[model samples]
Target chain A: MYVGFPHMGNAHIGIRGLFKALGILTIDLPPVNRLTVELGAKYSPECSCLPFKTVLGNYIQALEKGADCLIMLGGCGPCRFGYFGNLQEKILRDLGYDFKMIILEPLDWRQTLRQLQETFSPVSWKQLIYASRLAWGKTVAADTIESFSHFYRARQSRPGIITGIYQRGLEKIDKAYDLASLRTIVKEVEGEMKAAVLPFEPEIKIALIGDIYTLIEPYVNYQTDLKLGEKGVQVERSIYSSRWLKENFIPWEKKKKRRKMLRDAKGYLKNMVGGHGLDTIANAVRYSREGFDGIIQILPMTCMPEIVAESILPRVAEDYQIPIMSLAVDEHSSDTGLQTRLEAFIDLIAQRKKDKKDYFLSKVHEAS
Target chain B: MKTKIGIPRALAYYAYYPMWKTFFEELGCEIVLSPETNKEILDLGVKEAVNDACIPIKLFHGHVSSLQGKVDYIFLPRLISMNTERTVTFCPKFLGLPDMIAALDTDLPPLLDMRFDFKKGKKQGFKGFYEIGKQLKHSYWAIKKAFQNALHAQYEYEKLLAQRVTVQEALAYLYEGKELSKPVDYSLKFAVLGYPYAVHDRFLSVDIINQLRKMGVTPLTADMVSSKRLAAQAQKLPKDLFWTFSNQVIRAALYYLDEEKVDGIIHVTAFGCGPDAMVDKLIELEAKARGHVPFISISVDEHTGEAGVQTRLEAFVDMIKLRREQ
Candidate 1:
């Protein structure tokens, strides 16, 4: 049986590695493209968030490619993500797609394991442990590679080279079967990224904050992170899928970092508003305190949590003395518009940086 | 001087105002309610609230703004979960409504933001109220008596609702001792499903229920169905939906469709509501799969024109009538 799941940045690499170690043949669904967005928007509830539409599109594409089973994570929240599987299953079934859908809720691993055992060829405990470890390693490695690429992308003189290296590195990470090999592959990728960077370029750091899916998925955000990096801005994401998995699934994982974020957000937002709403606020504060240049919040149109964050963000921005630009994306969001916005924002920040430097130099001269 | 507590007549106020009013009044505090939603309030909400928030959230912000400086403390409960058996929560906006208000307008009256969650055991839930009582320096006995009275009022109000009285009618009868008016029955019964805030708020929903009455039709609502029945209907789904209100709305819609109780169902939804986006699809699919009960969804935002809503309602009622004639 061929397995399928939705794409969130390089998350598919980890999923592919996990299923492969279990001797499962996973279908490599094509990356999210215009056709995928079109198909997803066409069938999904008009007001549902972008992740639902794009993921539904992924499932449809996978089903058409002869995959008979799909697995999706479930959330428990005020977030609509928790119910995506239930509604998507009904929609797909209504549209006549005959595929078994498995929704794995967080903290219900035993049930998921039992279901997996029932559906596929039985795997020994040893193999299961090995598979999960490999999946975790690959996910972490992919995330590391992504961060390295983001750093190198801004400093590299040539356009598209880092993206190519990033893609090749992902391919290598996907093939590694154990932790040792995964580490080696990550180091190799890091070395290549280091070698590729040109002489020091003036760094204008921007925090990429918003809904996890929109922030991670390149196609959805028109590759805003990469675009900003290409335009010589260092972009750091607020959350990563691997980090999210570790925080939610691993019982031993200390959530001190997330707690700190909550504390930072306390002055602005009092509660966890579900999704990445609280994270956006906390990360913005963190970035501002660390002297980051600006913040770009990318969210799907009608996203509930981000909307709440967006409403409070202006205050956070004002109090912190940091520039913030919120971009609402939907199926109709054109890359040209996004690109223009990114360029304009970058220019504004760069000019602000220059003005600050000149003012500091003038102050020093006056003191002398 | 009597401590004045402001309760914005939006969101949970539509359902739990009587209980809250009873509790506060019993605690020797005067209650102040933001007026029934008007154009000015909606406009204020739209202006103050985040642009991406649904009309309900925006309206909620507007109500709080209207109460600024008028009351000593604004009551904005951070409603997390309503379910005891499982984890069902309010929309994230509800969880952060107090914070949103505090951030939007710093000069407003101090907010009584209490975290109300039934999922966190009975003791913890009571502690939320206990803390509120302590803040007001009320004795434990007084708080206990007030709590009991509030619960009784809420139970009675829900009973009145189940007895076929509209929320407004039930509230009026319970509070003012006004006689409950029997609603005029028409041949066509349409189950109007939505959160209480969206369905009962006259201005927000463009008085859809009264509009239906004018068209010679009976409007059935989620409130008329018992919570027990709604919960049972919800169990029919693969899993429980995350939000309490969404589950009720969906179950009410499902009950109508499965039991063949209504000729048609209309979902009055705030345009950008996260839960309704899913609930609406589920109900629509269920209605379509059943292939007998017709379903219509009316999306309302600040810009929702009354004429547009009326046109849609008339068309829907007309279509249902024609289908019946066949």
Candidate 2:
């Protein structure tokens, strides 16, 4: 059983597919949101967010799905997500949810020899490598198709239908497992899809900021990019196909380009300015420079990075004269209210562009 | 001859360095700290710390490793529980740090666990640092005198602080023999409630003072808050506080929120503390529900790289700004 939070916007189906392909029983969890929060809060210790929700949710969900060993995802950067597995295991065990947990800390090149020795000692190298590759491929496929769907949904005509078609085509391409063939599929189908979403000459451009997973994944964030695209907005995300490739693969050493996967998260972690905070600010500056009409910052309720971006983003918006809206999502997040606010924000941007005036807008509704 | 004491420049480093540095120096011992929390040091921490441990705990290990060859003794404060009641505790990683660092860094110096309450005296008793001093071959009187001087300096520092002098500023006044007066109205006090180190470290990733000063917001360190006082505040929540530091953090936030008269609160914790992970949502929810005042939670780790911490501080300031504007 693999436990996950809506930490990022990753769809579990593809990941589950990889697990199943590896001859393992995989349970796909219900998309995380406010409901997951309630369930997680009910059983989880009082304070932890991703862990509380994920541990309890994974336990109950996996238990419901009749899982054996509980596996959770992890990272070693700003989010503090790395410790979730151990912490979750302890908390759940105390509550009578007995299960095993796997926390795959990102490889640090310096510690590679030792970390790998420990990691590979437990699992077969073939299975590990295969699982990793599948995950990597799926991340790209999910991110790209999800973005394409979102783009077509909000900004294009007949968003719901056109995006559905685009997603279907993208999925077919993903299953190909080969880049050339997939590219061929896209070359053949993309022209018709782009033609379908017409009036693309001067659509409003929106840059997403906050919580890399939420901004990238469609399942958790409700295909926000697709929704915006169908509504006639050009969705730009910091995560791209090439960057993921460069980070994951570029063969290092005598092969010319560095081919070895970066063992350390130093580049990503020590960046200090990355995470959602750096990503959002950098993207905000980039979007503003690109003359983007607006920016949307999305993150979890307890995230620290987005909270930081929330402070400086207003200044960024002011400087660029671009409208910005930030949303902190949790289980209590209401779809209707969220959509209403997004709609209002979009309208505000469209209105500001027409009037060329300073139009301050807010999506944040204080509990008070 | 002065025995050298190694203080790792990590977690507890940011929190009690001044007190530790001054007290140890006053004892005529050489104080050497592991270099500032950086990539190399943090990597060392991750290597030495338990695989499942939080980044801070891992970093603490790296700090210990760095100080091993250089110092005769390395200080790893094993404060088990500070609250009177068994309700307050620290993260599991903190509780087991001595064994963890010792296991990983075999080349490390004898771990000096300045543990306040690890034994029966783990919660409600005075720590016999005099015994620790004797173990380090220092005369009990010298240890007592050094402790007394350090304690006095800390108390006087607090007096100056109550007059609105910061730790750094008070240090200056004490060192330079200058009279100190607060320029700002000790008004608009915001509690810096979290782990002690993250709040105190001026140069590391999250510069809370600069963050506060940038917006004219007065920052208060959580260290000023006693955990026993905060633990009394934690009675509202029904659960065992296993992680002692987190217990203090919880109590501090709640006490400041309901009783300390803080206008708002900011909780800075190592991003992955289980004890804190156990409580952040409750803080957010509590801050939201009964909050006439707001709470801003910040997570700091070596990975924070400061710029990210700054962004969060800026965002938190904006939230405060928006609230004040309204």
Candidate 3:
């Protein structure tokens, strides 16, 4: 059986590694591109969030490539994401596609495992453990390289150098056969990134937060993080795919960290509010308190949780004396428009910093 | 002088108002309801709410805005989930409704933001109410008595709804002790599905129910379907939807179509609603699969003109009437 999943940055690399480890044939899904969005929008509900459309497009591409089974993540929530897999299945079936949909619901791993075993060749306990380790190792290595590139992108002397290295590093990680090889690739990427970084401090630091899909998928968010980095701004995302997986599936340090996040969001937002709305609030407060220059929240247009966060974000900005902006993206979002917004935001932060320095200098002069 | 607690007449107002009204009234707090949707209220909601919010949330913001300065506090409950066994919840907007209202940057009375969840044990659910009562400085026994009375009021309201009474009719009966009126006979019945807030708000929906009535059609909404029946019908779907209202709308629409009880199905969706994006599609697909009942979805936004809604309703009613005659 050929299996497929949606694209989210470098997530496909790890999924492919897992499939390879499990001796399962995997379909190479076309990366989220113009055709993907177009096909998705053409078939999807006009008002469905952007992620659904893109993911559906990916599924269609995979199906066209002879994939018989698709894997999708699931949740139970006030957010619309939990129902995406089921709805997409109904839609794909209605559109005359014959395939199996495997939804990996959190905390319902036994059902998901049973479904997987039923659909694919049975795996022994040793193979399952090996597959999981390889998958996690590749994912963490990919996520680490991506974060490293973000750090070096702002300080690299030449444009696209860090990104080039990051891309090559990911390819190597994807090809690695075992955990030891994956670790070696990650360390090599880190060393290369360190060697390439110029001796320069970024002028502005911005925390990127919002809908997890838009936050992780560079295509969906129009590469806002890279764009800001190219403009000499340091960008720190509130969530990474590996971190999100760990938080959801791993129990260690989850409760304590979650408590602190909720504590930070006390006055602005009290409840979880589903999806990443509460996380956005908490991270905004955290980054502001940590003295980040600004916050940029990116979300799919009509995303329910982000809409709630967007409504309350102004208050967080005011209370923290920070500049916060939310960019809502959909199929209609243009790259140039996003670029202009990022450039303008960076300039505003720079101007604000200069103005503060000038004010402080004048005050010292008056005192003398 | 009694404390006046204002409740916006949107969202959960259509579902749980009687219980809330009884609880507050029993606590000796005077209940102040924001007036129904109006031109002025809609205008206010559109102005104050964030640009990205759906029309119902925007209209909710408008209702809250109107209640300002008239009451001691606005009672905006963050309704997380209604089901104990299932993992269903209210929409995200409903979960953070209090924060949205508080962020409007308008000066107003203090907000009595209450957390309403039944997912916790039954005892814990009432404990949340008891905590709210404590904030009001009510005695423990008074709070317990009020809680019992509120549950009873909610029970009776559901009973009235099970009898096929409209929310408006049920609310009127519960609040005023009015007798049930005679049911109007109709030639065609359409299962009109949507969140109660969007469907019941005459201004937002352009009073489509009454408009259908004028055309000799009766509109059967989710509220008229009993919870047990809704739960059972909802199981027909391969998986459960996350939101309570979305599930109800889907199940009610499915029930009507499967039982061959309705001539057609009309889905009233607020423009840019996150859940209805999935719910409407499911209902439409189900109707098409059945290939018997006619289905139409009417999308209402803040800018939805009365003429547009009327034209669509007229056309839909005419087409379905033709189908029925054939």
Candidate 4:
């Protein structure tokens, strides 16, 4: 049973192949879909979005296939992914499902190195290096393929062509026996996808805000991009991969925060004043300023940090006149209602746009 | 020269509203209640509150926003503690509501931060109330008399209810020209037991009474219990009561069982409500041990959806029916 990455940069490309090499019984399902979102939402709570429901739906799908253990990625950030695991466990338990949940918490460089040393058993650098290289290669392949597909989906004139194309491409990549074959297929598909150009439509935009995991993870978020793309909506999702953040962005942020944020007073008060961190508010404000359609605030259920974000979402909605539909995505959330809410919100967005247009026209008429 | 005071139909409303109401009236200050919450009020709350706030905090915003400029000052009672142990410290939101209110867009009257210290019984709590009354220009003797009369009025009101009397029956003695007790064809027991704000805020759990009645269950509120006795029983939980109101709910559950044992208890809490997180668990455990009492805990936050709640209530009722047949 080869398991796919739960979400985002974790497409589990090489990871699944490695499991096969290690004789691990791993099975990968087709990534999450809207129906999966619907099913999850039906049985789930309303505070959640499609992604939370989709991921649980994915796991439920996985369990039907005889998988015993469920593993989820973990991280600590403003979004509240850290505590979602505990809630997910409770939710699954509430539904009478039990399985092992291995939570892989994000680690610093030193810890990562130490973990690698431990996984090597008897501490051989060569074996660890080889494993690392193999995983890295698979990741590159997965990222490239997935990105190409997502990009294609975004640009395609047709609503759902890329989803099918990616489905075919994923099967092709999965069937490859060796890295050479995988690389060869990737090269072939990459060329083909690159050639399949899409139309440029920058009219309606939707900003995805929440924990980074649910935003980018196809498995977790139920391939929300596909749904958005199918609707011919341009999506701008928050991209804060934990690995990327720790390696590339964290130091820069720490340095900036230390100089500007010694005590929590600035950060705390900013959140205290606005109800989430000031930065998130600023980011949403920036999105508003950039003239995005509307801000979609999403996060896991029972998450505290994101509560701060939820508290001030109305302010953003009020100030920007950009109807914000802040979603609290917990495991219990329903899919149909979420979709309906999103659809309703989009309807409001259209009306708001029309209202603005009418206002501008009326002003011009008055001047004439 | 007594200016009227306003009390929002919010936290501690169902519990101590009579006392607060009677007390104010005794002091010759007319009291006005903030309107019941609606979508407009909820939207106001959502707009006024921070994004990441608990449901009750949002509901509080709705309540406060409703009462803005309605009375001389909306009473934001900071009922810090009523007992020696401070057994319950409400969620940071409740403790900081005074500041929370100050942060709102509405021009709130200066808060009546009604701090209470029941360590030496009721002296300090009353003294705090007296100070507020004094500020309202009651004479030394008048304030004392008002407090005593308020206490008597509240006691009389509750005693009548405890005698299985209706609201009208209870008020017949309390209100001189009030109507006679007309027995409400409603007797469904549904302990809306939780921290003060979550239970009292209407927008958060809108149509609760109607919803319960629609299911043919007349809702019996836990707030109608004796707070002092209930607070004592609240200490029975695994985690010591840290918030004053949580203790009240725990004790209310106890009193409901030992006194007016209801068929079921619906423990309501705001989503991400810290106290109810532990308190609900304790109540469930304690309530379960006392026999086939069906208990359900419903957590509501800003994004509260109705479908699941309806299902849960239906399921809980079914479960209760099953137990009854057995």
Candidate number achieving the greatest DockQ relative to the actual structure: 3
* Cα displacement (Å) at residue A137, model 1: 2.4
Task: Write model 1 residue lDDT over A1-368, tens digit each, in one string.
Answer: 88889888889988998899999998998788998888999999999999999999999899999899999988777788888888899999999999888989875668877887789998899999999888988999999999988788989868888989999988888777789988998889888888888889647999899999998898999999888888888888988899888777666563775677789898888878888889888888888899889999999998888888888889888898899999999998998998888889998998998999999999999999
Docking class of 2: incorrect
lDDT tens digits by residue: candidate 4, B1-326: 56668776666565466677767787788787777766777788788877656666676677887877767867776555545763333433544455456545567876665554455677776887788887787877887777777667667766665554534234345545675544355545666676645654555765454567677675655546654665566445423444566656777788877777788989887776644554565566667678858888788766666776778888887777677689
TM-score of chain B of each: 0.97, 0.77, 0.96, 0.78
DockQ of 4: 0.08
Better of 1 and 3 by TM-score: 3
Better candidate number, 2 or 4, judged by DockQ: 4
Name the better of 1 and 4 by TM-score: 1
Model 4 residue runs over 4 Å out of place are A1-25, A33-55, A73-84, A87-98, A104-206, A211-214, A217-234, A240-269, A272-280, A289-311, A317-368, B1-58, B70-193, B199-266, B269-294, B297-326
* Candidate ordering by lDDT (highest first): 3, 1, 4, 2
User: A59 in model 3: Cα distance from truth in Å?
Assistant: 0.2
Model 2 misplaced regions, further than 4 Å: A1-14, A33-35, A45-47, A50-59, A107-135, A170-192, A219-222, A240-274, A357-368, B1-275, B279-326
Give candidates' CA RMSD values in order: 1.8, 18.4, 1.5, 10.4
Per-residue lDDT tens digits for candidate 2, residues A36-130, read 55667676543344434644664666655655566555444334454455556655565576555554544434444454344333557787677
TM-score, candidate number 3: 0.98
Better of 2 and 4 by lDDT: 4
Candidate 4 residue A353 C-alpha distance from true site, Å: 9.3
Supply candidate 3's per-residue lDDT for A17: 91
lDDT of each: 0.87, 0.59, 0.89, 0.61
DockQ of each: 0.80, 0.05, 0.88, 0.08
Ranking by TM-score: 3, 1, 4, 2
lDDT computed for candidate 1: 0.87
